[model samples]
Target chain A: MAFAVHRPESMEAVIAALDGTASVAVSGGTLAIRAINEGKSFPLAIVSLRRAGLAGIAQDDGMIEIGAATPIAELVRPDLAFLDGVIASFGAPAVRNMATLGGNLFAPQPYGDFGVALLALDASLAIAGPSGKRRLPLSKFYETGLASNEIVTGIRFAPPAPGTWRWLKATRRALNSAAVIAVAAIIETDRSGTISAVRIALGGVDSHPVRSPVAEAGLLGQVLDSASATKAGEAAATFHPCFTDTYASAWYRRRVLPVFMRRALLGTPLETMP
Target chain B: MKSSYVSFTLNGEEKELLIEPGRRLVDVLREQCGATGTKNGCGQGSCGACTVHIDGVAMLSCLLPAELVDGSEIVTIEGVVRNRVLHVLQEAFLAQAATQCGFCTAGMIMAAKALLDCDPSPSRQAVIEALSGNVCRCTGYEPIIAAVLAAAATLAKRPAAAAAA
Candidate 1:
């Protein structure tokens, strides 16, 4: 149960430390520490990402680049105001200070709202492993999982135009609770208020953050409204085979998905919607 | 596994120890340094009882590896007192009757202290967000939230009074 922790200070050092060894990389240590205490099947060696030169935010051209190890607290800045509500909806201030964007991608379902947001943003991840460095779409990373020694180095995404990104995390409690149904979408409406392009991503409904192609397909050319939002939500829920746990049940999630989808698009509460 | 020498500033004092690799910061603070002011309600990070400040940010000490914090400055509940006087947040907690069972008081005070240190005037919603990770089984969160807001008001007027005896 005891493992030696290795703190590598540079990208090269971190990449070299992952030499096909049985080690787990820890950033923030919020999730890993819990796993360790619970006596679950975990790695014998921990490579601390604390000193791994993977913390900061920068913008190049239209792309916003975030270091994988940057704490969630750092991301809640005024410049990135769209994410303020989402990040604030996560764990309390203490947990946010200790949780990292990279760790959220690896956190289990119902726990990674940031991942859902990134998927909605069409973010790309820069990964390093034994072979070399490669960039892949965030969704691809979800499907392929990680190579044995690979570590997610950073994420890059072109910022969506204003009024395009929408996120809502439905939690039983306003804070510290897992998502009942977390939804994020990037939708562009024409001057006539018809949907031009739409990408919808969801959390807490699947094993990993996922895109709701069915929902996107349902709303592409329609004028977004309560009715269209309801239909799109239904399409998305049909694709989500929700699982029941202590937080909520599958039936409860299915009942609320339509309401949340309407809220995400129409910006109206379920009760207010016609 | 070999024990490693971990060094960090604890409650403004430099500390070094040959500690087990899996040792958590909360255990080290309570067991080794006898700083029991930081209670452990739930060994998991869900309960804010093990909250502390690392490099000036409030974090769950239970989830931090003692080795990872080497050379970092840490502040626990014990560090909130200065010059034999309670921190303003603590004073406000007492004034607002925020303690019932007292198990979660230390962590709540530490969490509120961290919030006030960063934002002198946190809104009601902000206070709720800051202390959301901490759970109080008794005397629900309204009093605690009120206490934090009051402390912010007092600290804003006499900023240095918190450390004065």
Candidate 2:
């Protein structure tokens, strides 16, 4: 049986096409294409986002606006150095060329490094749905899930201050491996070196990426150092329960979450304790 | 649903064909186009044996959808050879024994071609990063990496050779 493909040229066309029976939106197609090929159930029509006028990077007034359908490979600009590093470690070169940022947000757990990074960046998403257009913080979007007829149009975030954003992914290999423990954060200190603000996100340890509220609370108003980072890391582990899988055991992930958390915040090596 | 017509440039020549929706690019290249040079190491996107150049970027043909190829330029392993002569990277692989079972050579050459086309002189880490999508069971990666570097040097000195590639 042949599947119908709808190539829409604008956001309105995409939103209208999505209203068709059993139609779904497809951007980049790295995951959706594979899922269809693997004999998973097919939608009657696919609304391709490639032609939907949603593939560019722009910055205005310190806010970076990225078209949701923009390929991860195109995000290697000098201003996005940390994102470049994250993309390099996200997948192979071929994968990077095809995977889209919007698709990454909806990707299954353990496969969305970009999602984790965006969550920590406190990014907001502009989504177009059957009702109308609306904005949602990445955290709320993840919590509430997307409506079947909604399509993410863009992601907006301000670049974090220099040296304020820290990220680390402990993987099975140096490149393109699934994370054993992935962490990203924006941590700030006051003039006296006390932790003033923190936003931490974790991946690979749960069914979905999550912000570590316990860690943030633990680190607030405390001195930013190895000891405090270790304490916050331990608290972060309590925020989520790990599960056993092919990549790692639940016990192992739980035991190492603190180590990765510390390393993400304090720049400590994985094997060494603070 | 009906099969859609896809017209794209293949190896510098415009080719038109009708393919069913959801048909993978690798299948069309191998079955319909008779371009078996692009092998399918893993039908999933894991192995790079089916790598091809889509719009001057290296991508896994196995992961590409047939409906997405309209108006794009695609080059498989068959396109890598010019004027009945092997490309520099192919010659380097031959001299360095970069192939073991030879299942991955076409994809490796295509990937190397994409990398060199963009950055003629890539560092060792860059070469490794470029080929990270491809996996080979034989010859280890040392010879393949070395072969890519050697081909880069060959292209550096001979501008015509680089132009032909």
Q: Which candidate number has the best DockQ? A: 1
**Chain A, model 1: TM:** 0.96
Off by over 4 Å in 1: A269-274, B162-165
The residue ranges of model 2 lying beyond 4 angstroms of the native Cα positions read A268-274
lDDT tens digits, residue span A1-274, model 2: 2368888899999999989588768888778877776767477887789999999999999999999999999999898986766887888888888889998998887788888899899999999998999999999988898887899999999999998888898787787787788899999999999999999998876777888899899999999987888788888776688777777887887788888788789866646744
- Candidate 2 at B59: error in angstroms? 1.4
Q: Could you tell me the TM-score of candidate 2? A: 0.96
Error of 2 at A252 (Å): 1.7
Q: Deviation in angstroms for B9 in model 1?
A: 1.3
Which 10 consecutive residues of model 2 chain B have the lowest summed lDDT?
B40-49
lDDT of 1 by residue, A146-214 (tens): 887888989999888998888887889867788999999999999999999999999878888999999
Candidate 2: fnat, from 0 to 1?
Answer: 0.56
> Per-prediction DockQ, in order?
0.77, 0.64
